[model samples]
Target: MRRTPADVWLALPQPFLASEALAAGRTYDQLRAACHRGDLTKLAPALYAVHREWADLTPAEAHRALCRAAVSSLDQVALSHLSAAVFLGLPHPAGRLGKVSLTALRSTRTSYPDDWRRVLQADMPESHLTSHDGMQVTEGSRTVVDCFRQLRLRHALAIADAAAGRGLTTPVALQAMRQFQAGWPGVLSAERGIPLVDGLRESWLESASVAVAHELGYPLPASQVWIHAPDGELVGRVDVLWFEWGVVGEADGMAKYLGAYDDDPSPTAAGQRVLLERNRERRLEGLGFAVARWGAADLRGGGDGLARHVQEARRRARPEQIRCLWRQDLKDPLQEWVWPPPTRA
Candidate 1:
């Protein structure tokens, strides 16, 4: 039995290729009719997608679709910058970013870059190249440092911390790349943001929040510290610990507590998660630490938004009451976990 356009459209992937559709039993006339009827949107020469589904995607998702198109269109090109970050699974700030990005040993078209793609001209070493699925891509550390040089401080730190946190790369390697690429466009921003990365941060939200804290000139806090009761009972592992100030800053994402409440996103599940958090806060406060939580709204507020919430906790915390119950495995941030060979690594 032959498949019709409707059948093939649903069967094919989002942002699929003209050839993919034709291969999947769509005739040339049907592909054109679909395009004419607004059933498909052309992303590039041969790349296309279901129009309605494409419209519903967020910026990041849309970019991933574009990256996939680039993967299909180019032959032997290394995906670079944010496009490389996408394939590497590194987190980036939310927003519409520019064209699909790639790297070539040298530019193929001397006249112009493709309307939808940015091809970086470079002679990057083989060591700095890797692959995603089958498409050539810059390696993790190289991708990250590339982004750091291209993006601003807030966006760069999030990517850097995520790369470090996941064991994909180390701050030391990032710094070395910055020095090697010195005087290249935007290298100074990379150099500045590289020092602020802490691999212990578990999420992009936590990393970005700390980046803002740096700009606000707030005291830098310890990342991922464990607090124990004097009796040796583990109270909790915290996101950010101002050890001396007795402050515990928690970066609460929208879904942090939802999954544990049975993956049920109902109001009841939300309430249960809040109850559990409240209970945890009471216990941490019992240990003389004032616990504060910040969310995306706080980060979005800008100015003194997240800062106010954490600083308020600081006001309530008693440094004199701070105790040795919190056991921090990494006392020094610059121990540079991935560089020094983790005792366990």
Candidate 2:
């Protein structure tokens, strides 16, 4: 009943310590040989994962794996900041994952590798800690606030919006959390950004779109607004809506359209979806709503690109031309799609 390296790797929890394998009757030489043979991939010092699992992961997943490995190796460390955001599944600005973030009480002297970034604080509130998939993580509200304090305004708002939209926290709660950290270095920035968090946003792109709109000084638009045709049929739900301005803003992601029809992946299918989207835009135009669409490019362009799109929408808007209903008389079409969807007690 001698287990092979693959069997040992499969049997142990992922991102495990070398000592665990040794304890299970696996020799140190065997572990070294497995790593040398590509059966086990060294994540950090002493932490290993099956080579196949490590190689097949997306960048985000790989980053999480590193975070998990870091958590497993460190003692009295609770994941915080961007690392906590990742664990909580909140959206964050793109950044390198070369370092893992952890928080510990100022009194605790915990040594970690150079790759670990430790944030020591005098107050280690119990309420702010929670267990996520067996790892200690800073709670969502605290994580969002920490992000707002640590990241740039745009980056922080993206995280806040994602957290709120996903029902992890609310603007009010985040604001209240900031009250205690008044003398903190980045409190003002967090205060200014908290009001921008909107829970209705369904995707990170939509949140980024809103952040860009805010940078352009545009008024906050209703999110997830329903648009109806003259015949009372649902046209679609717009990402951002400005009723008085007669403009509808869509944060377009190509992935949303592709594979939408019959799960097709060919170029022809993609072209067909594009044509259908164009026709849908035409219908919106006919109803007197100025349609403003921005894709990943505009998002990558930063605030300037978003401002340009908003200016175009403003130019095209004709409030007098609007004939479509903003709200439906029937039950909310997207009630079920709401985040933290209703649960039976």
Candidate 3:
């Protein structure tokens, strides 16, 4: 039986190129008709995927799929910046994947589809380039550095924290990259954030909370600290821990729990999870730690609001109420060696 274009696309591996389909004896008109019929989804110009498969992915995953599909069509370009971050499996702020970013070694007048963005940069050394699963992308250190140089401070810290948290790169490596970027725009912002990067930040919201805390002159907090009850029973792991302040901060993003527990898809499961969290908080409070909880609102409201909320919690933390619970040390060895360690003159 002769197959339809949609059938042809479904039969072939997903994210296939239009040229490949044409080579397989499928007419362009048929491919267009399949798209019109909503059987195939266009990932990029001339790049298509099975509609059902594409629909199953989250926005971030879909962005990654589009980037992977678009790479074959990109000429004289290597994925860099945010695109590299995504391709390298590094963390980045959540958003639409509006365009695929590429970096070229030299100036080029080559045109790409509207969805493709080319950055003509001559400073990308060969060492910074790497190939992952047949797709060329920037190395982790270079990718994080480029991201720091391009993104705003909050988002830059997010990328750096994610990179460190994932063990993809380190502050020392990023500092070395920064040395090469002297006099470059956003270099200072990048430098300021590199040392602050912590891989223990399990989520972007946690990273953002830390960034906001720093902006408000709040002493940096230890991440993922263990809370124990007076009887030595493990209470739970708290998000941000300030030992000296005897305060703990929680960066709550509903997506964290909801996304993980969506399999149940019932109010009962969600209520149970909420109750569990509340009980955990009560247990920590029972141990004499002043707990500060902020959700996506404080994070989105900027540093001032988050700082106020955190400060209020700190104020309420009385020395009499403070406990002497020992914090488990989970510091990264890389964090101890200072960036640009002092040199005797």
Candidate 4:
């Protein structure tokens, strides 16, 4: 049977089990064969679906398919972490497929046999548990906390950003929740990841910019800022802007420039592009903004390099430089601007 676009759209970026596909009036063997022949993708054992031809599959679809498979398999596990973030309508990076993270109480031993991982939460609170679309998962707050414990700070920040953006977790509430979990790791994780959620960035670059700055004692900027032209057309916002230093920092990861070349040839064109950014930089510089460009090497490398870069930009900076940069240009005046450079001298 030909499933509707909606049905098929709901079963990607994660696998579906055979029996469930059969119940949906789709032949499992047919889909399996397509995956075997490279016509489709097998997200897990006996789970099959047509691959998305354009963009990556949606998170809801991934969760739906995984939940369906778990239910059909009669498994006790439920989606969690990045997968759960997707299910909860929180944005996450689609590339990492280390696991279709699942959480279950009392630990079950079923295995996917391919492209799946099972995570056990031995103490998942029963009251904070629920089933959605056939899979079991911890409630929003619990899921957010669990992910913070397991994933990297950036990934955790992504989950928290999504959660907070949707009002699922507020700083005050989360901070209060931390009091319930005692011990070293719990305390450390809470200390590190909580305040970051108040204003999380949409992209990994922005998140990294936030973290690195915080780590290096440089005040983090308002990420993904929107700078508009006088006519109201959006120009562009720097990835990171120090409103107090008149310094605009961007994480110029290789992907940014390389992605443009891959997406279209025009961005790499001689006069068509190189000149475009040059003009953009000139306009920003003319506004008394000093733009500092950092790449993936600096971000992924570590603190010393990034610290030096930010420090050099702040050395000898005046309030007027930042004052005009924010007030006249970006329209945001930062109050945290320290005077006398904090006297390291």
* Best candidate, lDDT: 1
Runs of candidate 1 exceeding 4 Å displacement: 1-4, 8-13, 17-30, 44-46, 52-58, 108-114, 260-266, 301-303, 329-345
lDDT of 1 by residue, 1-345 (tens): 232456568678788877787787677777777878888877777778888888999888888778877767666677889888876778877888778888875546421566788877755888888767777788878888888888766677788888887888887788778877877888887877787888888787888888888778876778888776676676778999765467899999877776643758888888888898888889988767798888877877463678888889988987566443655673632221121112320
Report lDDT (Cα) of residue 192, candidate 2. Answer: 74
Query: For residues 61-96, could you state the per-residue lDDT of candidate 2 as single tens digits?
Result: 767877776776656778888888887787765645
Give the higher-TM-score candidate: 2 or 4: 2
Score residue 220 of candidate 1 by CA lDDT: 72
Candidate 1 lDDT (Cα, 0 to 1): 0.76
Give residue 37's lDDT in candidate 3 (0 to 100): 81
- lDDT by residue (tens digit), candidate 4, 162-239: 677667777776666566555525557756777777444556566655766676666646666554443444445667
Query: Which 10 successive residues of model 1 have the least lDDT summed?
Result: 336-345
Residue pairs that clash (backbone atoms under 3 angstroms), model 2: none
Error of 3 at 77 (Å): 2.0
Identify the superior model by lDDT, candidate 1 or candidate 3.
1
Candidate 4 residue pairs in backbone clash: 16-47
Worst 10 residues of 4 by lDDT: 321-330
